[model samples]
Target: MEESKPMLRLKRTLTKGNLWLYILSELKRGRVYAYGLSKKIEKEFGWSHGLITSYVVLYKLENEGLISSEFEGRRKYYKITKKGSEELRKAKRYLQQLLNKL
Candidate 1:
């Protein structure tokens, strides 16, 4: 059966928009490598969309300058940038406003 519009939107929001938020939130703690990110999200958030999806989001975030990465030997670790913190603050405010309205 086909999904409803709201359900589709929820799926998209959770998978994409919120994935970005979650990644940024986790990075707030400290730097984490790609493989470790998947595990950390699953443990902290109780859900993960797999490594491929996380990597895609990581690449987009890096490209947008929301996060930066450094090589630790063969592994790459990611940390949030100043711009990323500002964006996260904006998102928090937006979410608070939306919640208040609800």
Candidate 2:
């Protein structure tokens, strides 16, 4: 029998800003296009994200200098910069601290 909607686990949907860590972490893996980043987020973290939101965050990060992007033909690939790495470390620590309190 097919599972009913109530019996099925809902897909985890994340708000736009919630993706900072996922993007940064994936960028650490290598440079990534915004589309690829969003797919990886869903695949690895089970968080469903919209393409426009992901690109918005990407542009924000780039503007903040936490990430840099380059155009290869029509694709823009992003990589975390040193500052972004520092921020990622700080974010990890914050998460750790939050978990410890729970």
Candidate 3:
């Protein structure tokens, strides 16, 4: 069954809002390419926001110094930096606080 437009929009809104946190959490596990990040998120969280969005977020994260990337042969693998880990911790705390309030 197909989801309605409103539900689809809701999903995209929620996923896009928190993609950075998801990426950082996954990268904490190990380095992965942009595509791998998308797959992992889908497998774990059941959210597939699209591959291009992943690349766009990755580029932004790299620029912000939350993550670092390296080219291994031809593939670019990304790993979360210490700053990213710290940010993830903060984000988790904020989320927990929000949940507790509700």
Candidates 1 and 3 compared: the better one by TM-score is 3
Q: Candidate 3 residues 9-62, lDDT tens each?
A: 977776777798899999999999988899999899887778988998899999
Cα lDDT over the full model 2:
0.84
Tens-place lDDT per residue, model 1, 19-77, is 99989999999999988988888899777677898999999999999999999999999
lDDT of 2 by residue, 2-101 (tens): 9766545332223344678889999988998988888988898776778998888888999999999999999999999999999999989997998899
> Global lDDT of each model?
0.91, 0.84, 0.91
Clashing pairs in 2: none
Q: Give me the overall lDDT of model 3.
A: 0.91
lDDT of 1: 0.91
For candidate 2, the per-residue lDDT at 27 reads 95
Task: Name the better of 1 and 2 by lDDT.
Answer: 1
Each model's Cα RMSD: 2.9, 4.2, 2.3
Off by over 4 Å in 1: 1-12, 15-17
Candidate 2 vs. true structure, TM-score: 0.82
State which candidate has the highest TM-score: 3
lDDT of 2 at 48: 76
